[model samples]
Target: MNAPTGKELEQARSSAQENHRALHRRISRLSDDAIDLILRDARSHYAWKDQPIADSVLHELYDITINGPTSMNTLPARFVFVKTPEGKARLAKSLKPQNVPKMMGAPVTAIIAHDMDFWKELPFLFPHEDRRHLFDGNPEYCADTAYRNGTLQGAYFMIAARALGLDVGAMSGFSNAIVDEEFFAGTTLKSNFLCNIGYADETALFQKLPRFPFDKVCSFA
Candidate 1:
């Protein structure tokens, strides 16, 4: 596929903005199919079909994911989409042997990371208030806020992928130190986890794993 030109991308962005506006006008809750697509039927895929994901789709996924709320509107997460052979090779160095096959099979392996200096962006990301001051001279507070909010964004990314008819498999079976050194060297970004995104090979999946019943895990406050 040809790369999108600057003009084409701008046009796409304009169309996407209008589409998002239209979505806001719908006040009703999602139907059962939507529920299934986003969660109920979604599985952590360990294998993938031999297909490719376009960059435009990734852009749309990110656009949706960022709309999720974060503490003080501090969007602390950064993502590296590994699609090239070299990129995937470097990423494989961090994965456990059991996880390597699945990661390499994925069309894109996203390195979800948190910027330790995310507070510095608050002047623009959260311009309505001076929340950056809340982290001044406090390394622990900065670390906590970044990691917490970054993880939320990573989860949001997976949901957004599912909403776009893509499958995701999130994994922690990797060495963060290796990932950080390979992909984010000399930066404040710290790797949180890696997630594979693509069309899944359903035939390779085992039956859905059991989950705790609502009654077992939930209670009215």
Candidate 2:
């Protein structure tokens, strides 16, 4: 797809700002359809249409999701978009049997991971102070923080994809060891999960399952 024109970008920014204000000011609740598009009625799709997503849209998805919060803005998440047959073949060896077809059918699958040495970039991402020293010698702390923030970023990725008119199917049933060997051989990164992205095949959707009520999962502190 072609890049958005300057005028189009400005219009999109203005519309987004207006929507943000409206949402915060309670001028209007999100339309039910809009809510359904992103959350209320979203589903974990197992089947996908043959349509391909544009590179520009994939870039936009990352641009939007990168703004999500992280501890000390550590921003540990790293993504590998596996789209080609060769890439999918490499990933296939790591996937569970039931997840194989889903990954192979989708147009793209994201290998979401975290950099264990994320603190090395603190000088740039968290420039206020020398926070690198905090995790310099602490392997346990670094691992925990990387995994936690990386997983959060993966959630942001799914949300961003949904907002941009795509469907998502996130799964954890993969062999981390094989994936790491195949993809992160020389890097300090470790796999957290995999998420498939594409247009959904609505006819293949399973029935929506029930969710826990607020009273059952929340507390009045």
Candidate 3:
């Protein structure tokens, strides 16, 4: 597809804004099929175009994802944008042998991470009593909160990408320790997952994977 012209890009943004407004109005009322499309049709996309996923789009994506929830609102997810060659090289070291090609080939990959010391600011994020003390003696609480909230934010990233007509390939097949040491250095952040963001190449998709039957996967109780 041709690159969108200035006018064309603005028009697209206007259209997207309108759609966002419409979706926001009925946030909890999405049809079952629409919700399924968001979950089921969402795939771990790999192939990408030569065109970049612009900085403006990344900003919009963050604006959408930070709206997601967390226990006591302790939003601990941190994102590292791996766009530069040096940065990509760092990420490449941790990727599994099978994931190397895709990670290297994608236009951009986001390193979703969790901050181990996130509770330090509980006075700001939790604010109800000295909740920071709740996590001080128990490191597992920090681990659990980071893992759960980071995963939720990662899922939000995928949904926000789809909402903006972009595709993502999210993967966990990487060495977390290597990533933490190489990219995050001395920071408290632990790597959670990698998400490749860009337009799709449908021709490269394999056959769709099967899903478990609802009867087997869900129960009213």
Candidate 4:
């Protein structure tokens, strides 16, 4: 597909803002199917059908996810889509025994990582002040910020994919060190987690797990 023109981009942004305002008015909620597709009925898939995710879908997923909010707009999340056989092989070296088959079978496995030097872009992302200096020599602060925002982005990614009719299986059962060495070598990026994406096999899914009620997990101030 052709890249969107400046006018098209502006139009899309305007449309999105209109939708955002509509949501706040309580005049409407998303259609049941749409809600199910993205949340209530979505499951953490472990098995996939023999279908492939298109490159365009991956691009669109990122486009949608990048719009999600980040702390100080420090969008530190980076993704490496492992779709090819060679790419999967490289990823397999870091997978745990229980996760190996799942990774090998999925159409794509995304290596969600965070850039340690993301604050360097604060001049453009946070522009109002010179925020980059805050992390210039503070390794601990930079690491904490990167991991925090990067994990949020990873969740955004999964939501975006589900909204686009894809299933997601997010896993943390792997070696971050091995993934960083294999995929992020020579870069300041460090692995956060892995997610398998594709069409899920409904028959292969386990029973739905229960969640805590709102009152049990929350408190009013």
Candidate 5:
């Protein structure tokens, strides 16, 4: 990679400084209304335009995604990008009827998978202790770690897409076994979810769905 130019560094510094306060603020201090705005702004987009996501843009997306939280920074998530017609066709076989139409229409589908062998890399990730020892021979613990952290990483991928001004539709109505066997053959990585990504088709958006209020979902000591 080439060295960063003065102009690029300056731009990065300016952008960093502008969001410094918000970036450093604690999550607990954020009001429910503000949190709602952030969550609402990160909503999935159903329909998409005919444009294609460039390879360079995909790289940026991955770069941003790896920074999300994970248990002991295990970093178990692995992504499979379906941009070819053949790949999409294979993935389509696993999708439920309701998800097929929207997914098939999108430009790309990201298959988020979890690496069962992620513990092997825990030494590099959590160097303070040999956390790998916690997972060795403990199949149930390993499985739970992969599934939970993989799901969290998948959410980060969606937010990264949103941060980059791209629209996303994350769907869970799909077959995990079929997806795993077909796409991740011989690998420990297993499918978590499918996220369709592209520019939004605003005309196809349905009415906003209702959500439960805080009082019913929270309690104070």
Candidate 6:
């Protein structure tokens, strides 16, 4: 588990390039059914089955989530899995009234948050370049990078959960100030959104909503 040195790093990079070349030659793609499972068919669940999620599952979810890319590899997102009745009760105070029951029904609700001081880890995360000092004394840069990348990670969370046969209901209707005060006090972490994860109560699911067509939302340019 030692860190790769100069020669080792070069070899790794070459191996990666070779792998990418192989992939390009093959042009592997996800099956349409697999796509449906992760994005098309997946619905934002509102109710969950009584089954409980284990700590190991949460750990596995996080392990998959961090593998998704981030700005300068900052990896700003932090999570708080609220699963206990007491924790859920506390979290309920920060959510909109309508969302409280949805969160409660799910066995685990993840508080997806970002750290304003995440730049401190840049030196380690983005080791190829010394990016650690780039955000120093810059509130705007810190806030923007953390939020943008953290939100991307949040999206990855839902997709990864679906791939793992878990239902997800993500929302931003919570009071950020309240959640921060209650769950992230004395820390630099700021709440981005909440995602409830568990097996869905399919009978309680609503019809999937429509999305903007590719033509309407995109352009050839």
Best by TM-score: 6
Cα RMSD for predicted model 6: 2.2
Which residue runs of candidate 6 sit more than 4 Å off their true CA positions? 1-6, 21-27
**For model 5, the run of ten residues with the poorest summed lDDT:** 33-42
Alpha-carbon runs more than 4 Å astray in model 1: 1-25
Collision count of model 1: 0
Off by over 4 Å in 3: 1-28, 31-37
* Candidate with the larger lDDT of 3 and 6: 6
Tens-place lDDT per residue, model 2, 1-221, is 23345788789779999988988898557788888988998999999999999999999999999999999999999999999999999999999999999999999999999999999998888765678889999999999999999999999999899999999999899999999999999989999999999998888887899999999999998
Quantify all predictions' global Cα lDDT against the true fold.
Answer: 0.92, 0.94, 0.84, 0.92, 0.86, 0.90
How does each model score on TM-score?
0.88, 0.87, 0.83, 0.88, 0.83, 0.93
Residue 196, model 3: lDDT of 89
Ranking by lDDT: 2, 1, 4, 6, 5, 3
Indicate whether candidate 2 or candidate 4 has the larger lDDT: 2
lDDT of 5 by residue, 32-68 (tens): 6554533664566778899999988899999999988
Cα misplacement distance, residue 197 of candidate 4 (Å):
0.4
lDDT of 6 at 24: 78
Clashes of 5: 0
What is the alpha-carbon lDDT of model 3 when measured against the actual structure? Answer: 0.84
* Lowest summed lDDT window (length 10), candidate 2: 1-10
Residues 68-109, model 3: lDDT tens digits: 888878888999889889988888989888898777777889
Evaluate model 6: give its lDDT.
Answer: 0.90
lDDT of 6 by residue, 70-119 (tens): 97898999999999999999999998999999998899999999999999
Instruction: Give the local distance difference test score of model 4.
Output: 0.92
Which model is ahead, 3 or 6, in terms of TM-score? 6
Off by over 4 Å in 4: 1-28
Clashing pairs in 2: none
